[model samples]
Target: MLSDPKSRFKPTSTAVADKSNILSALKQPYSNAARIAGTMRNAYLTNGSVSKVIDYYQSHPTYNYNIYPVLGNKQYELNDNVRNSYIDIAYYLRDLNIKFFAPIFFKETLIDGVTFWYKYQDKDGVGYMKLPMEWCLIRGTENGVYRYMFDITKLNDETVQSMPEEFQNAYKEYQSNNTSDTNTWYNNKYYYVQENGMAFTFDYNSLVNGGLAISPFASALTDIISLAKAKDNVNIKDNLDATRILQQKLPMDKKDGEMLISAKEAMIYDQTIRGRLPEGVILATTPTELENIPLTNSGTANAFDTVNKGLEQVFFSMGGSSPLFGGSTTSSNIVKEGIKKDANWIYANLFPMLENYYNSEIATVKTKDKLLWNIKFIRQSNFTLHDDIMNLKDQLTLGGSRTDYLAANGFIPAEIISKLTFEQQALDIDSLMVVKPTSNTLSAKDAEIQKRGRPKTDNPSDDTDRLDDEQG
Candidate 1:
């Protein structure tokens, strides 16, 4: 899951805090089976079966889409009860003999490395992990096949104790009843994974790509709670430490000098001026052209440097320089504006019931798998206010200092180009409901580690030829 503390895609500070809080809160034992059944009963009964349960989810604010049925990836609030309810339903599915994911589930056991769970309802509709939000967004697999098949690995907890004996025996009984070799990701750990039937080779890095930002705010909140109660192992400190950095690669050149007249003319000729250079054409004279330099490695999944810069402009255009940092008066003002804007959104207005739904509906008053639960919900939506806050946080802090987007001049590959449509298309409801961990009331060690400064780099390599190669 993206919630893994060791996630390669380290979430922003807010996300980190949110995840940590959820984990802290969920540390106690929970009744997974019972909780799921309660949600299923309500989701199915009040909403009328699985289909309507999905409908109920779509209509909520946190889940609402500027474009209905097309849910944006982001977080929705979940109290302890809400998460427990979700677990109950998934476990119910496992018990019903309607075997769709057992193969993936069982195979992951061999590796014990998979952080696996299945989401029945997505912001858009069903099967977000496998399905694309839109028909056109489908890649790597065929379209419309997301409902039935799955690409999954098992999750083993080594830091935590292993499953109890009774649970293991029950699982064995189920496996014995269903005996078949299906190709799966863990079939060999080398390639194919097999369990009940389904199988496939595993590509760990690509599969566990970007999705949603989990909240570390809850972690901070928990630290406050733990501190009042006295804690030692947990840390709620927040800063740039703990090594959860989000590095994006973008196509940009250092802005040491003017853009090449040839490249600038290329853009101008492409549309604006639509003609050849008169005759005095000196490539260095063009002001808009960008040099071919690696601006930054993309951090925002499909975003390239040029596109990221454009996004940077739009975000800053929202009266911000980068993502928000809520300590100073300046940060407070921006946070207020961002929060207001997020709350007053068109989509946010339409489906204002999302938070309550998670609280009152999805998360059924239990903390079972709370961390995983939050990560799953956040990952399911894209059009969310959470993105808005995240974008703000990016601008105000380290994001403001990042040099990734400075040198880009608009060249983007076809694949990443599609995702760029997020610019002003519509507000993703998920962003508004999703909150990053920003509570300062906690005294957590993780937060303290984050507050620590860099130990300093002592690189001895000198690049005296930098000026000559800069082409300034």
Candidate 2:
């Protein structure tokens, strides 16, 4: 009655067509979507305000991260083997140089809504190479898993040869198939294999749309265009304002509009005026009047202001505060809080996504032994150190461990323990500290020595003895 239950799991015709079109579109030499991606990248490169917004995203305060084992959500001390394994992972991560790539990733993701990197191996070990967003496409998802494709035709021969053998073979087979069928050449002639580690994507816009990644700047594209036009207009107005015009007059005769001067004389006068004037000066003559005018405030008096407002609007549309690009004195507090919120949201979402992708796709690619570990990237800049200290203090007040306080405040617990042991045993630093008794302890011990209640000792010898005893 259900008519083959497995048939329901198959991809629909529309989904298949979409996937095919996505591949074909990206593979084409001049796809509009790819061009738009290129344009966004170029804007970030060329436009100062756009660059500032993107740099803000990239320049968020960075934090150190460590990988910890997830041992069933129970409280247990990490054994030496596990701790050493985590340390090894830390060293591997440092060698991987992910910190160097992270800013690039942030910039590209802000522009393209997605970033791609190719994973490869050589004598030095596993490495990642960033691939152009315009050359990459998603082939759709299978069972909630995404599969990616890259336009091999866009890549050079050396890069293609450097890929994994599986990917290389697939590319060669596609080339052979296409060469055999010259009449039916396809736009999606490039090749890719499924589930290969050759390429992976950082989809910042994952699941919001289908497989395709829509740029974050997509919605603000119209504002960006408008802002560009506004800037051009401003430039034109500024040029006009920098220009000057001159007017000259000659004495007129009273005989009923008789020419004050002959045409030849007028031409001579014009030449004289033009030759006398410097650059950016224009002149005109009339018999009745003479005036000189500079082209200041031409076209519109408020054109510069208009440009400024447009810039602010563009920054706002790009999900950035006006102060980030320039000055916004009136809304400084609001913008500061807004930026803080944006930082929190981005750190919460973006960092975790990157961490997870690195852990699953990169850190574990070389070996399976790291499957149990995850690199926890806590953003240190999300909160100020003072705020963190206060929170830790509150936590300590509520019966949290002092070791937690030390660890969370960027101190290594084991290193602190070892340092303290050495300081006590070798340096004898503890003996230098004079431990002062608390009020309650001192009161309980020296109750009889209250100066108001106790009389002074009259005997000089006894007084000297008491002083010696008190000093000791």
Candidate 3:
């Protein structure tokens, strides 16, 4: 809302928790990553700005008419751009470092969609959903495309047991699980058999109109993220009140319930804890004493204010000496095409806040919450945004325009291209053991089990199907 142009103040907070992100969930069952990837891809293809190859087919009249026979979805025939839409999403995600899984959808909590299939003999419909002769993408990149095979068979001995229940059911209903036909090939190690190697082919799109293709979408990402979080709250809210939500969900074995410092959250928390520190930690405390500057021991407001005043003068001196905002901020500018209000606000608000932040951060390096947590927080910059929302100011606007001084790092999603003056480089496994253990030795096991991989079963073919789908 801060970026609404009409909105007057900036947003600020250190409330971020990495409840769900790309790598963490994907490390579970391949299905989890695949499902999330599908959502991301679906959003990418369905988005209006992606300039993928699909747009070509979708734009054409003749090619648009050639689909009903292949997939049976009337929408495919009318949509024309089906293939392009799928792959373009793949391309866009590749840039964000998204990993892809295909063909077999392993069952796990990592994904957000359901398992759907047809062709079943069930009076109760539950087992029917597991049958695969008739299959639905249920989730992943396809927008509404479901594929079904009729009169499926089954394979024999080892192969039958090797398949995921979902895939095996589909195979049995299609052709009685019979892969005696040489068409059987190794997807990874498991045997995914079709009378003729007619496996499903999935693709990735790395770039779109030339920006990051986020799954939840940057604009409405909170909604998707909220759904993901609501799932987490389901497990967490039962024990604690609203105030202790973060603490209860985190690793409290330390000084009680505490999360590993979020470098970002720590930045702001340090500011708060700094007030509780002693006088020596403030005027007399040296960087060497930072370790001793925790909320366990803090200074008074008078001491904190004293330090803030001195620190502010120094930061401003440096900012004043560095440079001014005189460069062109239009699209024609190589680095920054157009300057944004938020970007400009950064120079005015956040930068100034940094002066105070530096002192606050340094003073409470050893403090609780923000200091020891590593949660990066922007102290009150130009605006007094509350302590509930995250806010980042645009510092670099290259190919775009430096002129767009955004108050919030809203463009973090846009993957604003830049010549990073520096080259670079999640979750605490300690806190996430639900069905598993939570103590020391158990925590170790939890680490291994939850270690984050493309959850594959005893069967390796899930890996192989992935390879085939990617290669195809």
Winning model by lDDT? 2
Tens-digit per-residue lDDT, 1-472, candidate 2: 1123333222121211122343444454233445446556666766788888878777764544545566664625555466456545555665556666666667776776665555565446455555555556665544333456666565445655545575576567666665333332234563443443322234434444433564577555556666676777888887888787777776677788667689789889989889999887777777766545556776677777887887888788887888755666676677767677767866775676667555664345343343356655545554354665577679787896565555556543334455666889988987887665433444422523642222234433543443323434
Q: Estimate, for each residue in 346-365, the C-alpha lDDT of model 3 and write its tens digit.
A: 33432332223222222322
Give all TM-scores, in the order shown: 0.18, 0.64, 0.18
Question: Which of the predicted structures, 2 or 3, would earn the higher lDDT when compared with the native?
Answer: 2
> How many clashes does the backbone of model 1 have?
93
Local error of candidate 1 at residue 200 (angstroms)? 20
* Each model's Cα RMSD: 31.4, 11.7, 35.0
lDDT of 1: 0.28
Candidate 2: where are CA atoms >4 Å away? 1-32, 73-80, 120-127, 140-147, 155-169, 178-190, 193-210, 246-278, 282-294, 324-326, 330-332, 361-371, 382-385, 389-472
On the 0 to 100 scale, the lDDT of residue 274 in model 3 is 61
Q: Write the candidate numbers in order of decreasing lDDT.
A: 2, 3, 1
Per-residue lDDT of candidate 1, residues 345-443 (tens digit) = 423322222222222222332435343321112211232445543563466565441211211111111112233334324446466556544333323
RMSD of 2: 11.7
RMSD of 1: 31.4
Each model's lDDT comes to 0.28, 0.58, 0.29
